[model samples]
Target chain A: MKTENNRAWFLVLPVFALVAFSAIVPLMTVVNYSVQDIFGPDDRVFVGAEWYREILQDDRLQQGLLRQFVFSFAILLIEIPLGIAVALAMPRRGRLASLTLVVLALPLLIPWNVVGTIWQIFGRADIGLGGVLVTALGVDYNYAANPFDAWATVLVMDVWHWTSLVALLCFSGLKAIPDAYYQAAKIDGASAWAVFRFVQLPKLKNVLLIAVLLRFMDSFMIYSEPFVLTGGGPGNSTTFLSQTLARLAVGQFDLGPAAAFSLIYFLIILLFCWLFYTTMMQLGRGSQQ
Target chain B: MARIELAHLAHSYLGKPAEEGDYALRPTSHVWEDGVAYALLGPSGCGKTTLLNIMSGLLRPTSGRVLFDGRDVTDLPTEDRNIAQVFQFPVVYDTMSVFDNLAFPLRNRKTPEAEIRSRIEEVAEILDLASCLRQRAGTLASDARQKISMGRGLVRTDVSAILFDEPLTVIDPHLKNSLRRKLGEVHRESRLTLIYVTHDQTEALTFADRVVVMHEGEIVQADTPQALFERPAHTFVGHFVGSPGMNFLSCEVDGGCAVVDGRRIRLADDTAMDGAKQGDRWELGVRPMFLELVFERPTEGVPVRITHVEDLGSSKIVTATTGGGNLKVRVGGEEEIRDGSAWVVFPPEQSLLYRNSRLCGKSAAGQP
Candidate 1:
């Protein structure tokens, strides 16, 4: 057998240079800022680990981090299983199947900021449709003044906008399965629940893992939607870590503290994502053996 | 095991039976004896699979009852019918070990742990998969996965019947022969009712004890392999049951002789025309293997023009045109003939006569 060889690295050199210039340079700048104390633009002092210490001691950052964890966990709990169920209900072949897919994918195509803005108006207690309906139903429906109402509105909006992504992924996974599997399940005398548990669920593991990780990362770093909808208002009840970081860096121009917070945020996401990826990959390998 | 019966079963995918052609499967009645191996043989779109599905309770017949052991099960679900089915393609859980795949049905029924292990071992050994018991089923080759699927069906000994729907179609030709032989051995050892469905006549004839020939949504004949070949109950059966099939030639019956395009072929007995009138559209059917090729001029033989000759190692299939229609004759080795100049004869006793597509009785001299 002849082994073919070619030089393809030359073509990718420019992309590598561009990524390093944009990503590495900025990341180093953040690291530099994170450990320094700047009295002004011209005078700066090297204060190693001082900002890190401040960040750790700050109670507000801790609250933001806790809220971020809870929000991401809650989103995952609601989306993954619901997506699988919807995908199972979808038709397998023909025009109806494609049409259902297109419909499910519509919400995902909407820009994240636009999604937040739309829900902001839609959830208004005094003028919007959601507010009018809730008020007419003889209930107190004030999202502007109530922290619980604001959080609930943000969570529901995120579910509505993103659950379809998980569903679409799961739908494709389910479609890839041949009809022979179901036929065998039938002949094996499997109950409906058993079929889903043994055949369908195990098959969907890869897709579900992807859905979980994507939704978790997105929810953890959520800023645009809640920012537009509630402005992290009602006394920081809806203020997540991303929103808090933005408030410090862009809102108050505390670049040093914000850069420190950003590193923590990045590490947290990287940690969780790594955990999710390794766990799923191990599961996939285990099944193959 | 239970004797399966289909009573006047007919099916149509259309909501209303608008015309005679609307039915996908025409009404017919047949009985399958318990513990007997049967094959439903037909071409594509012949409703053989549909009938098998109906029998397995996967598809309810549009009309009529399906009885098992004299009890109507037409409305029963597949799980309640106690049937194990192997499909055209392999279907096994990728995450499960081969042992688990074989033990799945037993586990579903809550079979004891020790029994599950023993049964799984038994089935795996039978399928030559004992060494791969702990490996995941999905990582194996397609043929191995198919064996796992077969084992899953065979592992359960309590099922009333095992249904195989073209299970060997996806297997390699060499592996198919071995798997088929293994299936025969397993069938003999277990004596479970087996219903094999296939479009390939070779597989059907070699694997089945009683072959059911189906055509155009109806069964034309059901009998042992020898009976189907020697005494076909319908013209379709004769054409569908043999390799190269039966050669059909158009003919007309006069007083005591059947006339082809222009030549009069002698009949062994005049009673072949007992119920036939003159000028009736008739066809004479003969198997290629039964038609003897003559080297010298012989009396009472039809003249033919040899068109093509295909030689197998032990025999030669000679294709010839006679009376404006084509016929195939299988001659033994060492008999040589030149294409376009060879002549042949059809043994009168082995010929079958047909009228309006149904078998008019056998030739009066009888089929040998």
Candidate 2:
């Protein structure tokens, strides 16, 4: 005969209830709304796979996705190398290091919407410092009237706001390396470029992976900053995926299609994150072998 | 190989050292000849690692001149000094293979590709790392990584000296002895000036041709292993070199004899007593190996109460108390020692007198 003690499961009941109430219930409601069309409180009709088909066929959603991909890719390319360079140039010890760390962390602590509002006013051609300085160089710069200007402004704003996070992560990674490695490298007669390539870069792999994945996900699902800054742009030039989903759900009240779009957006982020993680890990392993 | 000389070397980490205690290495002068293995042995915080780093050019002494083959290279960087140092913990490039790791130094000097490959092969064979030449250095066991660290030092042929800072500290106990023996063989084959720093006496005595014993940030003695064992220059050396070390007892000098607790123990015949005034302080120093425990009390033996006996397979260390002083005697393992009163005998030839921690006369048992 087997004696079983079931009281141990009681310890896990609260966590299970919390997750079900917070996550599962809302997810199931979204699934329900995705498959049915509701015209009124009491009148509804069941529609299987119609909204998914329609959202996939829509040209506006496709364009929004392309814009989102370009923005994320551009952000990653500009921030990672710049962040590493900044981290390398920063001082490694004493009062100057502490002061630099506090200054680097300042931008990350500001509210997301506040960051957008600051950049929105900061980019005005008439009164803002950024605009007056750029216009003084005698190049036509008007973000509110030109689409290209608006896109460039938004990309630059995002880089300025988020690059410090990447730099801070890289700084911590660089600090963890032992001084013995540099000493050994000096004795081995390695050049500065060799030390950076073989020693510094290899040691920073794990932190760089984290920085890439986080920046990718956050930029893909970005809503508040762009909403407050350009309001999806001067002429839909910077209209990304989250703005499109918000317009479909709340602006037009297209509940079924909006629900379908949300699911697709979540899945896309998940797929890309998996791809980034696996490819980088495979590269690391390949080097090891 | 080159003859390395340090002239008036002293180091202080502080910007302005006010007193003698602020200096890590006090002012000293020494010369290390070419093609000899020397070990710097000292306790923790005795400036052993500091001296090693200074010699390797990883650190610049506050005031000193380091000469290599009669040329001053004190201001040279580590790479320009033509010296290789293996750190206390193994340092290996995680991204590189063992073959690449060994070829790094040679490639930096712009050696031909063929020569680099041949040198790596030779070093790998000598270090028994030939089978794992293609393996990633990061994935190997600790001992293997340490061997690769040693191999990197040996791969470079242009280096005038190779320094090791407690290189085998991270290896397993069973492998430490074998690695130590391999280092001795490598030193003999390469004939390069090798300086190793370690606190383990067995490793120092076994691996180096001459050992420099350090105490309180200063080198007290530099001699062969047998000489260090038989004739220590200072009390610190006599206490530091041997297992259970040399036993010291406070004694009152009475002409040519020393009185310990109202019992007279004769000092060596050569011990100088003519210069000694009345009420002079002296100590009798004797090694445990020379002290014997006799079952029957002899006229010259002092009675002792055996407190403990430690069986060490080949020998037994008999610890006893006599006249308010502790005496440890090493005897054969099979030698039976009773727990009650026993007599301890200190050989007259093996015993010497120390005045203010300095040897009073030449050692009679071992040739100086």
Candidate 3:
């Protein structure tokens, strides 16, 4: 038998300390705050699961949660495919590739609030070029006056600002594939579509997973762009979960319900992430040795 | 199967090459015999792959034409070339099953589904991929994946030729032989023209009846294995095709003698002192197997000082310093060398003469 050694355990101690300070401690404080009614630091009373029950029963938050899911799924459906298409259409190499990359990265360089403000004016239907052009094109386009318009404006704004992330991720992934694959495909008499479906799509699995998860989380917790562009306005049509949580904790100062709501929200996101990761990993496991 | 003629073929990655050095493949004209297996042997960046690629239509040569059975296919795309190539690294559709991977080319060519199935079964059995037919190709080990890649080429019954560019490079050392044997068996059964490219002399010599030796983007010599062994057209072939390869010693030719380091060694009585012998460069080439070592001084041979001995089980290779150079002599297992100073004999019949890096007078015997 080999001799046992516990020395390796100490090497991981720093990581544990880091997680405790960064996540575990903060999460525990939130948990502590959620279970107690804190009128002030000195005045407090344990309320059991009352905050959780109240938060779950909240009508506005329920609508916000539903809206959040719709928004997340909507953005994912549009961005992932659009990003892949953009990446596919982009030049493979040379000066044009550099120019396209810089142009695509321009959206990501703008701050979230600035993107929101830019669109807010751009969707005005009065002085803004975008709004004026659309109105002149005979479409009734006004983000401030209609709930559907506000929602559409927010979705469009998010796509414009963030689709580049997925595209760039996929671009780098596509570049990493060896030239031999394409040559082999050519020799095999594979059509253009067949090459994409078999060689490129399978190779892009891991990158697409990362892109999807990042897009899901970001879109689910979306707040700044929609807030600046629509102000959760036109009858709360664009108010997502993050906005609801913010209003609870800061706007109404209902920290107890907000903490409980956020804990539930965090668990939901974690659950979906786990679901996506496991399903993707298990897709080809059946045929593997 | 069809004969492939590469007529005045040349390629340079540059749009317009200004010099010979710019070419990846120097202008070459060669005709591959139908149903004959050939190996293209060369060092790295020697344009063997470029030539193979040109044949398979993966690359378009800057000049010349490729004729398959007298049909000009120089401008054809790879799909239209009706050829297949197995790459150095394994290339398999990650999501495809072994059966599907094998049937991919057939499917692309619109072969009947039933025909594809039967063809795959035959190739799968040949490659021993029958057991893994239902398994995902990407999940298999590298050897299995490579087999799948090769099976794709084998499934095509109508291919004019099949090209392999260092196909066994990624296989496990123990598995390379098994795969090579499987490939050889397939080639014999299919009898399609095979152009196997490799830097390994053993792989080329053992696999191909005809071995084409290349150097620096040019075909140095194309002949049978025995011809390459006995009479290499160029010195590069002499140095590239043997186990230890042929050894060369610089010398000057005068009448029927080769003067080496101020010592006169008699050449074969039939040595031709005509045009080929009058070149500025002269060297004598001989394989280790042809050189003999004797303790007593021989009147016909030169003297050498023994420096190193390597025992290779069945034979011993003795490195000797002679004529301002070193030569290796292969000795049989039972032979014993008793002297550090011995007379190294170059057998007249087996010895080769090279002038300007080519076989002098068409052969060692000085026949025109």
Please, what are the lDDT tens digits per residue for candidate 1 over residues B211-234? 988889988888889978876767
The residue-level lDDT of candidate 3 at B240 comes to 86
Clash pairs (backbone) in predicted model 3: none
lDDT of 2 by residue, B2-64 (tens): 999989988899999989899899886788899999999999999988887888888999898
Which docking category, incorrect, acceptable, medium or high, applies to candidate 2?
medium
lDDT of 3 by residue, A1-289 (tens): 8859889899999999999999999999899989999999899999999999998888988999899999999999999999999999999999999999999999999998899999999989999888999899999998998988888889888999999999999999899999989999999999999999999888888999999999999888888898898889887888889998999899999888888998999999999999888888787454654
Candidate scoring better on TM-score of 2 and 3: 3
Q: Is the docking of candidate 1 incorrect, acceptable, medium or high quality?
A: medium
Q: Could you give candidate 3's per-residue lDDT for residues B1-368 as a string of tens digits?
A: 89999899999999889999999999998989999999999999999999998998888999999999999999999998899899988999989999999999999999999999999999999888999999998889988998898889889989899999999998888788887887788888889888899999999998997999889988888888998998887888888889888888888887777777777766664444467524479887889999989988777678899999988989999999986599989999779876579988888767767788877753644311
Give model 1's TM-score versus the native structure: 0.88
Please give the CA lDDT of all the candidate structures: 0.85, 0.87, 0.88
What does the interface RMSD come to for each candidate? 1.9, 1.7, 1.8
Give candidate 3's whole-model lDDT: 0.88
DockQ of each: 0.56, 0.54, 0.66
What is the DockQ score, from 0 to 1, of model 1? Answer: 0.56
Which is superior by TM-score, 1 or 3? 3
Residue B147 error, candidate 1, Å = 1.8
Cα-lDDT of candidate 1: 0.85
